[model samples]
Target: MEKIVLATSQIENIAEILEPENKNIWAWIGKAKKMGLSDYALGILPKLRIHEENEMEGLWLSAEEPEYIAEILEMENNSISLGKVKILELCSHAVETLPKLKFHGEYVMERLGLEALFSEHTAEIPKIENNSIWIGKMKRLELHFYAIEILPKFRIHRENVMEELVLNADSPEHITKILEAKDKSIWIGRVRKVSPIEHAKRIKGKLDFTLITPDDQEENGGD
Candidate 1:
């Protein structure tokens, strides 16, 4: 029921007590925003209390809480890539307020800002036109469970510059089709328990694959 008003000095003091190694969470959040790590920042945003008086204010539930959140709306509005923020929050009230960005595709293009290697919706992959510049520039691609179903929709031509692929799936069977679909060699950077590491390595036609196995988790002290 108590509100911790946020100021530069106050944030630093609290962050020192909460995260000794990191001086302030706001610093990290700002860097995350600049680095386009919206998902990571959003994961911590729900616990925040948006101070009615000051939207930029940071108010956590308590000092004892393991996680903290802050109101980042003002920061987001002032971001260098404001359009990118809108694309990430497509269904939110923030995006709905922008009349110029009414159409999804054009504003998505605006959000891309000529540097995006790839983009996707919640469950749908963006349709890549033949003239699109991302053809040979996309070096890394990650396909989640639902995205796997539409794998056949896009073509990974031999000319593609893709060097890394990450398959996110709970069951090995779901991604088995993905491996079989690709005839060319792709460096699989990581697989999220989609298959036995050895089996994935074997069928994938390459020996190199990275997965955080239980042993690796134990060694790293587990997250």
Candidate 2:
């Protein structure tokens, strides 16, 4: 049995009830969580680790609503972030929040091709925000790269060859390196190009490069 005490501050409230030297803090936290006092438990936890969200809408909704996110983007503090994907979902599903977004968010949504609002608009959406950090799962290369190796977005056919920095991801040499980088941000210099491949058909234009798949380590073509 545990003794119960009442106090003002959180620490005073906890300390009055339990002696830290005699009590198992971690065990108490576990008991508190099991007893459905999670919010109360969190008041004493020293560190926090968040797991991934099971849904498109994540914890950011508690910070601010979709309207607030739209307002932040519109007003040029794109600095304050809601998840980009989550914002996209909100803009798609919650039509009420759409008008809250101004030019910048509208541009991104249109370029992402998520909504019909800009389907008829012809003006090009500009600004990739060169310094912004992008994080998302991406295919190692483009559809064109499946047929041919990497095709650099720009043709510097003969010049700037030394500037071409190639990264062979998932290679045997980098297997441990990637594993080491799992929890931390690996310093990738920049993303000069990104192409989204949403839909595709059989490549009737002949595959020049051999195709590899993870399952069975199968190969498609060689000669």
Candidate 3:
């Protein structure tokens, strides 16, 4: 176990000693500092030490590294101080391993919720294609339309409207005229396979559109 004395002033200096030649160790040190780890402790940390290994090997640390660090620090301090040290370590690991886990988890949960709703209702929802839209049946005579439309208003193609609208299988009159007018049967087939109401609810948020066109014109008038 490589050890360094952690005093308030020596924290930054200690971190400098552990800095890698290629990568900016300062950024990681800053992050550790933000998590309330002393600079000296961060310098000698197992994870940072692994960074000194071959570049191809990559730096890896276990989930318990922070807890271990906390334990060591507690022993060194001769007293227990309560704060976010443990939480920060766990969070850092989570942040390091998979940043998109939160988003992916939410998406999976939303899909499962929709599946449950469909099972309870015993109805198949109309699928929306083209514009990333869907129409589903929540109850008898009640239909829902959900979509993720990308727009500067120009991106809204005919496929968007055709796929997002759902129609009742038994009642042809309830079907939208636009979908009925389409030439391809396969496109219509895809729109008919929509997911249930619970899934549709995930789309309750607003559609965000990014402007690709530059706001300022150049001196030569080039785009």
- Which candidate wins on TM-score? 1
Q: At residue 102, give the lDDT of candidate 3.
A: 14
Off by over 4 Å in 3: 1-106, 109-167, 185-223
Q: What is the lDDT of residue 127 in candidate 2?
A: 24
Return the top candidate by lDDT.
Answer: 1
Write one digit per residue (lDDT tens) for candidate 1, span 1-223. 1122332223444444344454355434433322221222332332222222222212111111112122332233212222222212122111211121212122212121111112222112223222121111234444444333333433333333233444445455544544654343333333334232333333344223344454544111101
Clashes of 2: 0
Instruction: For each candidate, give its TM-score against the true structure.
Output: 0.25, 0.22, 0.15
Over the stretch 1-223, how does candidate 2's per-residue lDDT look in tens digits?
Answer: 1221112223345443345563365344322211111112222222111112211221111111232223223433223222222223122212222222221221111121112122111011212222132322211222121211112111211211121122322223222222332221322222232222321112211222223343424233312
Clashing pairs in 3: 125-194, 126-194, 127-191, 127-194, 128-163, 129-163
What does the lDDT read for residue 70 in candidate 1?
Answer: 27
Model 3: number of backbone collisions: 6
What 10-residue stretch in candidate 2 is worst by lDDT?
54-63
